[model samples]
Target: MLIHPEEILETINMVTHEHLDIRTVTMGINLRGCSHPDVATFNENIYSRIMRCAENLVRTTEDIQSLYGIPIINKRISVTPIAIVAESCQVDDYCSVAETLDRAAQQAGIDFIGGFSALVQKGMTPGDLKLINSIPQALATTKKVCSSVNVATTKAGINMDAVAMMGHIIKQTAELTRDRAGIGCAKLVIFANAPDDNPFMAGAFHGIGEPDCVINVGVSGPGVVNSAVRALQNPSLGDISECIKKTAFKITRMGEMVGKEVARRLNAQFGVLDLSLAPTPAVGDSVAAILEAMGLESCGTHGTTAALALLNDAVKKGGAMASSSVGGLSGAFIPVSEDEGMIRAVQRGSLSLDKLEAMTCVCSVGLDMIAVPGDTSPATISAIIADEMAIGMINKKTTAVRIIPAPGTKVGDMVEFGGLLGTAPVMPVHNFSSETFIARGGRIPAPIQSLTN
Candidate 1:
């Protein structure tokens, strides 16, 4: 853990000048004990269990932050998917449970609460169906609630029905809260082979196999990485690998320290340290900046994929060197609104949805922060999700889509979600129809690699 004086100066400069800080250090708490056959009993069990499990999360996180002097930007909780506990309840009962969970998060002083989720990678259970149906209302009515749906997997392929339903649900969710439709989308994520113990949102949840309680840290420093790249920008330089390598090393060290301290304070096992360079609306804290530093004027350009590929690789290598356990989507993110560089790129017409999709092949997630016509057909959105999931299934990498269809807004209109969720200018989609392709409601067959002789 010894850092040289020069390296320390560089790190300090990165943090002070750039917007470098740990995005979140989430503690995952399994809530299986909250299950009960009786609806009322189950509801009570859920509130009590979450309250007991997460009661110390905020305090423990604060203590660790004080001891380490490194900012743990978010003290968060992820629990077992509510769908699992609401099996016996009606749809209305599920919404009630969401309200209770939201209240518990507020009471516990947490900014966000995750795991209002359903896993329908293969097929939807009755409870799963009910929960999915209630997501729009639940999300609109409740504050601080996040939701995720896993509709695809490497072995099972994509569930078109579930995908289609989610498309309509996302639109309905937006319609229910037109002013904050994008906020619901910001809180919602659709995944292929989603992980249970991911400390990143809005997809994080305590996996069933994990212990009852454990601490996981998601350390972000896109600003740090971008600074290193900027230092190497001599205008005459050809390759930027060295800058990426060095920056990743420092970023991983920060993650390692934060993860260990949080785990120690909680008296829980230290889970993976996710070295994701997540961004905020603040200046200089951008994945797009890292890309621009690599000589691309904008992130969605042809060179963007090459830039992200190197960044993603260097991050994994450096994080792996710093910690034995490094998981989560430990790569760069290109969310349009969250990063100022990305927003400008979109405004200038330098970034497009198609180019963003290309970047996602090498980056962390897919089509994040993208906006389309408010009246865009549900089937079209489903097609987009299916296309992204198909990439993850074939490549066997974790990829997700978080798209917002701003209600009553058309292309070129801006929709603001406020706070860290930020504002996104509506982007255009292809007017060309994909109705026939999307309407063919069947699963995309598993990738060829799935067959084992």
Candidate 2:
């Protein structure tokens, strides 16, 4: 299947308001074999295996970009959860492992490394506890390292202990590097039903069932959708739906071509095309821009909800029609640091944590790229996670929180993660405490909507 020159140009015209393309195509690698009782050997094996598996990732990605003429913005690696492998090691070993992974990514010329994580929703084991405790220093001292803590799942419910722990960890991470606390948050994600083969960071990790090597494509085009919506001078639901369908179809076609080519180069099987509407710092290439096109004065206003609902539905409809294998969180993202529109909204005092959550009800993820006060308590952060998870559980959609508690920073402070992840101004959180409710710590039963015939 080839995209004709004329067709490609038309799609380009609709999408490229500026120079933003798909941001990343991450490959998740499982490293269970890297575990060894001997700490020194364990570190060596982990680094060597990752280097061997990902050595050609960057080169292969470069070749595909040249061939397709579509800029593949990021080349990243996600490994198996480190906590599982570090079970036999001491607490200090977490830093060594993290440093090794960070160096490997840097050596390989990759931008980010994910799966420095622990899955403690059910409960924490010795290794899980150690890894969790090491997060603050592990994050502060390393470059290119991303972390995640999965504290809830549909089957297991939420782990209040883990949730509370992560809240404190976030604070510690911020305090360690108050200047870059928001940057640390950009590398961390809190998840529910987090996918194993996700090719996006700060949440990607190799699942247990994934093959030894495989290629997955994450295709984004908020610019395209925004342009389509902008062209509809006087729009109705039908008109808006049609525009989204067409734009998603074109974007998926690009993803399909890229995925096949990358798989061919790496000698690996091609996986799903993630039709996620990921945004960037470029002008007009933003999820917030799409909202503005829907007639909102700015993002985070009352009209933002209706605008996001329309944009989300349209993207899904279009993507579903383009590819039968649509997976991942294939919807619009409103990461504050990453998107220029979102950054501007935060700076303008237009967007808040609550408004961000409201938008997540319709968009892809929840409470993404938000920065709060450094002194915010762990229970409060857990409360934030609980609130976001409630949306996912009730709506039966995947939602997550990636909040940054910049240490020593308060409302109105700004922190930069740099590069594609971008910069963000700290936003305020609700001052009230949710300790009593969060301390209750039990499974929130499945919503009534989840029950069927």
Best by TM-score: 1
Give the clash count for model 1: 0
Cα lDDT of model 1 by residue, 1-453, tens digit: 787998777666766787666778787877787777777777688778778777888887788777755677887888888888678664454788888889889988888888899988888999899889989888888888888999898888888888888889888887887876556777889998787668888888777788887888888887777777787647443346656666777777887787787777667788878888888888878888888988887777778888788888877777777777788788787788788888888888889888888888887877787778888888888888988998888887778988988877887787787877777889987787777877787788788866755
What overall lDDT goes with each candidate model? 0.81, 0.80
The whole-model C-alpha lDDT of candidate 2 against the native structure comes to: 0.80
Q: Give me the runs in candidate 1 sitting further than 4 Å from their true place.
A: 1-3, 90-93, 233-239
Residue 425 lDDT (model 2): 82
Each candidate: RMSD to true structure? 1.9, 2.3
Relative to the unseen true structure, what is the C-alpha lDDT of residue 115 in candidate 1, on a scale of 0 to 100?
Answer: 88
